[model samples]
Target chain A: MADGPEEIGRLIGLMARLPGMGPRSARRAVLHLVKKRSQVLLPLAEAMKAVGESVRPCVACGNLATSDLCPICANPKRATGTLCVVADVADLWAMERSQAFQGRYHVLGGLLSALDAIGPDELGIPKLVARVTEEELTEIILALPATIDGQTTAHYIADALPELNVTSLAQGVPIGGELDFLDDGTISAALRARARV
Target chain B: MADGPEEIGRLIGLMARLPGMGPRSARRAVLHLVKKRSQVLLPLAEAMKAVGESVRPCVACGNLATSDLCPICANPKRATGTLCVVADVADLWAMERSQAFQGRYHVLGGLLSALDAIGPDELGIPKLVARVTEEELTEIILALPATIDGQTTAHYIADALPELNVTSLAQGVPIGGELDFLDDGTISAALRARARV
Candidate 1:
C-alpha cells in the first residue's frame, strides 16, 4: 500500500475508534469521500471543518450548537418548568425521537458507577438540584436505562430531589404476546411494574 | 423543538444527509455531542475539526487521509502487488473486516448506472487502468455489489482491463438456502454463475 496523508489517516483512525467501525469501514468511508470529491466528501469535509471551528455545547442543557447555548436552551417554546433528566444524550435522543415529552432536557453524562468512581458530583447531581430551583421545575422524567447503573442513579436523584415529582420510564414485556411464557426476569419486571392486575 | 445553532444546525443538516439518518437521528446525535461535551463530543469535535482541516483523498487509490496517502496506502506491509478493486471504500472495509485479503485496494467510487447517467469515467475506471499499468499489480479482484449498477460496472471493468487477471466475487443462492425456493433474480443469477454442476 502507498502512504496516504496524515490527516486522512488520523480521520480514519478516529473513525475506526467509533462504535461499530474498524479500520476497513474508515477506509471505505474515506474512499467514498475522495470519489465524491466534488459532492459528498468535499461537502462533508467542509461541514466537518466548519463544525470543528465553530460548534460547541450548550452550557445549560448540553445540546450541541455553534455557540455556548444550544437551540433547545435558547428556544422559548419549550415548557420551561418540566425538566426531563436523562442518563445520556442517547436516551435524551430516544425521548426526542418519541416526541412524546414536550419538556426540556438535562443530560447526565453517565450513570453513577462506583466501580468507575463516578459519584454525584461526577454525574452532576448538584446541577440537577440547582436546575430544579433555577428553572422552577415540576416534574423530572427519568429516561435512564433499566440497568444497575441507571437504576442506582435514578434512586440517587429521586432521594436528592425529594420535593420534585421524579418519575422513571416504564418498561415491561413489550407491546405484544402473552406473559405465560415470559422469562423470570421479564415476569418479575412485569409484576413489579404492574399497573393493577 | 428548540432551534439549533446556525452552524450546528448546518452540521446536523449535513449529518441528516448521511445514509440511515434522518433529521430526528441527526438531532439526537447532535444532542449527544452537546451532553458529552468534555469527553465524546469534545474529542469528536476535535477529530472532526482536524480531519476537516487537512483530510484529503489518496491521489492514487482515492482513499481518505490527512496526507497524500492513507495509512493503508502508506504501510509497506500492505503493498502486496494484488489490488482489490471495489466500487466503494465501504466494500473495501467489509473485505478488510473479513481479514480475507492482504492486498491493497482501488475504490471506484461507484458502478456504472445508465439511468443515472453514470459512466466509466465517473467511477474512475481510467484511474484503475492507469494504476494497473504503473504499479507492479497482480490480480484485480472485483468485489462490486450484485445490484444492476454493480454488475454493469463489473462487466465494463472486465472488458476494459482484459490484460489484468480479472475475477468476480462469488454469485450463488447465498450461504443458507435451497435454490428451488429462490426468487427469479436469484435463480437467474445462480444459473448464470453456475459451476460445472
Candidate 2:
C-alpha cells in the first residue's frame, strides 16, 4: 500500500505496534489524528512526551508515579499496617478504583513464572519482605489472579512471611454473574465457600 | 476509577477518542506504552509531533502532504490527464493499495449530503471543473462509495462535467466474496452488471 508521507507512515507503523492495534486500525487512527491536528493530535503528542519524560515506576510501591513514591505510597493517611500485593501497576489501579483497600500496594511487576524464568527476585519478593518488617505491616493481602502462576507466587509470599497474616482474595461467582454463564470451577468454588446470610 | 497520574490520564483520555479505541483499550495501550517507554513510547511521541507540525492537505488534490503538492501530484509519470474523484483521503489510499489506477486523485473531502448541509462548493466542485480545463484532463473516474450520498455526488459531478468522459467504479460482487454471504443489494447489482465473458 502507498503510504502518505514518511512521517505519517512512521507514525502509523509505530501506532500499529501498540496492543490491540493493527495496520488497518493504525491507518484509521493516524488519519483521525491528522484531521484533528490542533485538538487531538498535538495534545496527544504533548501528553505522550510529558509522560515519557516524567512518568516512572514508584520506588516504594512500583505504581506509575512522577516522583519517587506513588500517590498511594506517599499518602500518610493510608493504612501502613496493611499492604496489598498485586501482579502489576494495572492491578494496583484496579484496586484503587474499587476503593475497598485503603492500604498501600506492592506491585510484583509480574507473577512467578517458571516458563518465563521469572522468580521471587524478579518480582521483588525480598523487597516486599523487607517492607513488611520496616513498616511493621501486620497483614499482607494477595490480590493476585487465580492463575497457576498467581497461586504459586501467593504461596511463596505466604511461606516467606509466616509471621504476618497473609491471605488471598476469595474465588467465587462474580457480581451479577449468572450461574449458566459461569464456568464449572467458579460454580464449584462458590458452592464450597457459600456465605450464610 | 482512580487514574495513574495527570499526564497518564490525559493521554488515556485523548487515546480513547481515537477511532476503534475505548476507555478499556486506551488504558491497555497506555500501560503497554509506559512499560516500553524507551522503545515504543518516545518514538511514537516524536513521530506524532513531527507529523502534526508538518503534514497538511495538498493544494492541488486535498490528499495529505507535507508540501504544496502530494507525491502523486508532484510525480511527472503519474497520469494527470486521467483524474479519479474520491470522497476522502482514505478512499484515495485504498485505490492506491489496489494499484489498479495510475491517475491523479481529487479528494472531495466529503460527499453531497443535504442532511449534513454539504454541497458542491464544500466539495471543491468548482475547483475540480477549473482543474479539468487547466490540466487538460480527458477522463474522470468516480471511485466513490455506492451509497445514497455517493450516488448523488456522482450524478452532480457528472452533470457539471457533461463535456468530459465521466465514469464510475463497477458495482458487483466483491472479489473472493461468497454468494451465500452476499447481501441482496450486491447480488442484484452483480446480476445487472453481468459480463458476456
Q: Pick the candidate with the highest lDDT.
A: 2
Q: Indicate the TM-score of model 1.
A: 0.63
Error of 2 at B127 (Å): 1.4
List the TM-score for candidate 2's chain B. 0.96
Off by over 4 Å in 2: none
Q: Every model's DockQ, to 2 decimals?
A: 0.24, 0.78
* Model 1 regions lying over 4 Å from their true place: A1-3, A52-55, A65-81, A134-138, A173-184, B2-9, B16-197
**All candidates' TM-scores?**
0.63, 0.97
TM-score of chain A of 2: 0.96
Local lDDT at B1 for model 1: 33
lDDT of 2 at A54: 96
TM-score for chain B of all predictions: 0.80, 0.96
The digit string of per-residue lDDT tens for model 2 on B116-170 reads: 9999999999999999999999999999999999999999999999999999999
